[model samples]
Target: MQPTHRSRRILRPVRIWFVYLSLCVALLLSYVPTGQVPGVPDWVALLLAFWCVRERQHVGMGAGFIFGVLVDIGYGAAMGQHALAYVLLAYAANAVSRRVLWFTPLQQSIQILPLLLGAQLVMVVVRMLAGAEFPGWGYFLSSVTGTLLWLPLHFVLLLPQYQPEERDNNRPI
Candidate 1:
């Protein structure tokens, strides 16, 4: 049976709430220190990048900025550090999402490498500017590990497929 417009509107909010809940869970998980999990990536960044790719409209730059601020507050870090990183990362993910149909899950995962790395680099630069000591190369490992986990995470999350129209026309007809 076809639902009325009112029902559709109601369901929209429910879907949004689910997304918000998932993000909150991801945030909480990020704070859980991994004990001897030698190579676990930054769960929050991985989740955020996935959200940026999958739900660009809902998880836009402003949302990223706000989330980053929250992270900074929670972790007791310099203000605007995570905010800048999150917003920049969100923008990068969204920009490339427009051309995403050409990429497989593996390719998309590979693409995340640069975004993650670039975001970390920005964070490092910001921290340096704020007179924070260097955390060393290990700090950047989170981005690398995050990128590697993207494909599996995407599959696990069951994100929506890219629309056919979004596919690039520059390739074979």
Candidate 2:
């Protein structure tokens, strides 16, 4: 029993690492070209928001900053642009984490839309500041799509983690 318990404890960190691995996969998918496809949802943002609402303690501003920097470096954007945006998004999500977690997926999506939009707004502002031309209203489409994706992503990603506990009806009083 002691050996089994010790091994279980060792696996806990590996499980936590799997979460980060999934996030990295989402980040990679964000950059996948879709042959002129429009409104490609920001997988990183969606994942971060979901993790924030689902496991707030695990998805903090630090995670946001790290992932944001990874995104900036991977996507060839200005340094600290995505970093700042993601950190702000994480902070906003964390602020309302307690409240948001109680809401259904649809409600959660509605509540989180602002934060997702805010992240995009940050990107736009940064680009504009750098003398880049506007990318048009189409740029906002990702937020909408990302919001729509929340329901399925939330349910699906959390499905494996949901474990129903059994009640002991035969216990002696």
Candidate 3:
């Protein structure tokens, strides 16, 4: 059976709030220091990428750009460095998300690696362009860690979507 108009209306606001809360959490994580971690912890990037997968329309290029700027401000990095990287990375991820078969955990895991790496590469280039010297090859390690973290993260946020799917399946013809 088709969803009633009232159900659709109720879901709209709920979906909006979900996206908003995810963005807020992403921003907050970006600011938290990693302490002894050799570089930025993978959680922030992984969370951002996970949000992009789940809420592509809501967390597209513009949102990614804004988050990047916020990170730069919070981290006191060169202006626009993270912004440019994030926007480009979001665009790439958005494009890939549309075509990729997302049914399997392996597929999703495979898809996330390139998106995370591309974003990190963009930041590396931007830093170099801005005359910031290379920290080391170790900087890219965050992308690896981020990609590994994506699996558990994706499943957690995806629980709501699964409930809706199961409910639809249980409905009578």
Each model's TM-score, in the order given?
0.77, 0.83, 0.78
Report the lDDT tens digits of candidate 1 across residue range 1-173. Answer: 76342122111122566556767887787678675464567666777788788778888788788788888887777898888998999999899886763567787888889988888898899999999888777788888788788878876665332223345678442
Report every candidate's CA lDDT. 0.75, 0.80, 0.70
Candidate 2 ranges with C-alpha deviation above 4 Å: 1-14, 163-173
Reference-based TM-score, model 1: 0.77
Better of 1 and 3 by TM-score: 3
Reference-based lDDT, residue 85, model 3: 77
Q: Rank the candidates by TM-score, best first.
A: 2, 3, 1
Q: Which runs of model 1 end up more than 4 angstroms from their true locations?
A: 1-14, 34-38, 159-173
For candidate 2, lDDT tens digit of each residue in 1-173?
Answer: 34332212111112456578778989899778664465888898888877876677777889999999999988888888888889999899999989997666788899989999999999889978988888889888889999999888876776555432444578421
What candidate 3 gets wrong by more than 4 Å, as runs, is 1-14, 39-44, 101-103, 163-173
Instruction: Find the candidate with the highest lDDT and give its number.
Output: 2
In the predicted model 3, the residue pairs found to clash are none
